[model samples]
Target: MKNLVALLLLSLLYLHGTTSLAEDINSDAETLPAFCTSYKCPRYQLIKKYEKFEHRIYNATNWVTTSLKLDFLGIGLAKSFKRLLDYINGKNSEGLVMKMTVPVRIKVPRSDILSTNATMSFFVPPAVDTLPTPLNPDIYVEQLPEISVYVRSFGGYALNSDYEKQAKILVEELEALELSYNSSYGTAAGYNDPLTFFNRHNEVWYMAL
Candidate 1:
């Protein structure tokens, strides 16, 4: 009876160890970006990781965009968001309702402290081919080529001021590391909506040279 009981204990220990090992392997093999969990978002290849930013190569994709020229980034973003939201909500020629995608993007100017002459864009999902025409004259579809960028992520309820401050920090870090990047403009990407009060994610991207 003693020997049998000892064998059962050893079998249990071995099983537990195997389970732990499998879990660890799965954890390491995770490839999806954390912020992409809630919706369909673009995927990228992680080229390198630094103390301040990550270098990634994103594939070519399509987007629906609208132009904005406002000194107040916050207000402009709100207006643009509503416009794009309408587009996905069947405000197009085809009247086809589309699902919302992740990471609303703003092509912000790096030369100025304020975000002026920006373009707000929503990513077109991979499944979409032959986009519908926008009812709004200002809204149009554009193709973005595959490109590499330096990305810095932060968590908070991001406002205009928040993005500006983070952009400065990201630039400083890149300069400190002697990295080459485009100075003319950067992209601000937000993963959460305004209603999401907690654990919000945002990113600043500089085009890699």
Candidate 2:
């Protein structure tokens, strides 16, 4: 009888262990992070700005160097404009924005982002770079374009995986709009705080074509 009891106890423990493991797996799958299909408004600060617009030019005739340059360019601009947000709106805002000298679009050709990076570098000024500034009480979000776009917002690092997910969601939304996109013409915008995760930082995916 003791042996049977022991076996029953062991069986119960085994079942409990399996059930817990299954629950954990289910919980983890359920907790899988979700992506937002709308825009986000984060607090921002404005430092200074030059009156009137200036046209910046960039040339990426070289492939390797241009790739790095484009990466830096994106990073710098995201920071600089975030600070500039303080000036445009108020001491507190949720984001920053600017009108592209030209309608900007991301075109990954032949699934070749590296080559496309070189070509895309031809759009912006070469010397122009993102300038970091001290945080202030302002947000400088750019004006929303008249062109219809399905914006997907995400937090944390704008990893390629997150981008892929957002891009897919945006495409699906656009399809519902009856608008055509090449699926390669994606434009990105995002915000991040150097200090905290709870702070408002978001990335937006758009179809620029």
- Model 2 global lDDT (CA atoms, 0 to 1): 0.30
- Put down candidate 2 lDDT per residue, 95-178, tens digits, no spaces: 222212111222233243433232211122112233222135232112222343445555564444455565566566656766
TM-score of each: 0.79, 0.34
Instruction: Write model 1 residue lDDT over 31-100, tens digit each, in one string.
Output: 4677866566777899999887899999898899997555422455556667887787778998766666
Q: Whose lDDT is greatest here?
A: 1
Write out the backbone clash pairs for model 1. none
